[model samples]
Target: MTKPSIVFLHGSGTNADIFRLQTRKLAALLQPHFTLLYPDAPYPSGPGPGVLPFFEGCDPFATWMDDSSAAAEDAYWSLEDDDSGAARLLESVERLVREEGGGGELVGVVGFSMGAKVGMEVVRRLEGREDAGGGGVKVVVCVCGTVPYRGGGDVAREEGGRRMLGRGVVRVQSVHLMGETDPWRAEGEKLVGYFGEEGRKVMWFKGGHHMPAEDAVNKQVARIMLAACGKV
Candidate 1:
C-alpha cells in the first residue's frame, strides 16, 4: 500500500520554511508510512520594510493577503487565476502524489493559521467538483484557522451553512491549538464549532498564541492528525 500523503500549509506571514523542523521530525518518524508536502502561501512580500502578506486586513508575523483595497483586488485576481500561488500549491500536491504513486486514497491536507482557511477553501472547491477531473478531499486538518469568510449577516449565515452541503459531507477533523491568553483563542473555538462533530478535537496550551512551543505539542498534534487520516 502507498504511504499516506500529508500536505502542510503555512500560516500567514510565515512561509513553508517555518515547517522545516516539524516536517523533518514527522518525516523521520512517519516516513515509509507517510509523505509530507510543505507549500508556501500565495502573497508576496510588500515593498514596505519587514512585511509578509498572508491575508487581507490581518498581519501576523507574515500574511497571505493585504488589507488595502488594491491588495484585495490583487487577492481576488490571484485566487481566480488558478495559476496563482495557491493553484500552484494544489498542483504541487497532485504532482507529488502522482510521482510517489500514492493514488488518491491516501491524500489529506493539513493547514496552519491562514493556510487552514485556504485548506477549507480547497476542500470546498474540491467538494464542489471545481477541479478539472472531479476529485474529493478525503480529510481536512485545520490547526488554527478561522471560519471561511462568509459575506455578513444573513448572507454570511446562508453561505457558511449552505455552501458546506455542496461538499457532500466528507470527514473533517479539526484540531485547534490555542493559548487561553491568546486573543484568537475565542475565534479558534468558534471555528471548531463549525465542524459539528465528525472527529473534532481541541487542544489548549498554557502559553500564548504560539502553543506548539515544544516537540511534545507537535507530536501530540501529529498523532491526532494521523488518527484522523486513519493512519493510526
Candidate 2:
C-alpha cells in the first residue's frame, strides 16, 4: 500500500540534510505510516539561529526566500517576489512525487521556522488551484512558524501591529508546534489566527525556536501528526 506523504521543510539557512538530522527521531516514528519528502530551499542563505557549532559542516544552507536583516515579522514586507518559496517548493515536491514512482501520496506539509511560512503558502496556493493533483493537501504541520507573506503588494495588510491575511483564510487541517520560550512564539500564535477554528491544533514544546528533543514529546508530536494525517 502507498503510505500518505508529508513534505518536510527545514528552517531558513538550513538544508534538507540538516532538517533530516533534526527530525530523525520523529521521522523514525512516522516512517511506517508516511513517505516523508525533504527538499532544500531554492535560494542560498546564511546560517539560521543556532545552526553554527554542531551543523557547521552542513554547509551551503538555503532559504525559501532571501535572508532578512529586519525583524522576523517585518521581513516579509521586503520580499523580492510574492510567491517567494512556495512556487519552487511545489515544483520540487511534484518532481519528487514523480521520482517516487507513484509512491508519493502528498497529503500534508510540515515546516519549521521560515519553512512554516512557506508551508502555509503552499496550502493557500493548493486551495486556489482546482487542478492541483495528488489527492490535494489535507493538513499542514507548522513548527515554530509564522504568518504567510508575499512581497510586491499581494494583500499583506497590517492591523494591530501584526500582518493579517490578505488573500484568504486557510481552512485546511493544521497543527502548530510552538516553543514556549521562543522569541517568535507570538508570531507563531499570530499564524494560528490565520487558520479557521475547525481542524486546527496547537501544541507547546519546552524549548526555544527548535523542534522537540525529549523522547516523550517526540512521541506525542508523532501521534498528533499521524492523527492529523488520518493514520491514527
Clashes of each: 11, 0
lDDT of 2 at 13: 87
Q: Model 1 misses residue 80 by how many Å?
A: 11
In model 1, what lDDT does residue 98 have? 73
Query: TM-scores for all candidates?
Result: 0.66, 0.83
lDDT of 1 at 225: 64
Estimate candidate 2's RMSD in Å: 4.2
Stretches off by above 4 angstroms in model 1 are 22-28, 46-63, 67-92, 99-106, 129-138, 150-170, 214-216
Model 2: per-residue lDDT, tens digit, 73-139?
A: 3544332355534555666777886676257667878899988877777777677674454347888
- Scored by Cα lDDT, where does model 1 land? 0.57
Give the lDDT of residue 86 in candidate 2. 51
Please tell me which predicted candidate would have the highest lDDT against the true structure: 2
After the best TM-score superposition of candidate 2, give how far the Cα of residue 154 lies from its true spot, in angstroms: 15
Once model 1 is optimally superposed onto the true structure by TM-score, how far is the C-alpha of residue 6 displaced, in angstroms? 0.6
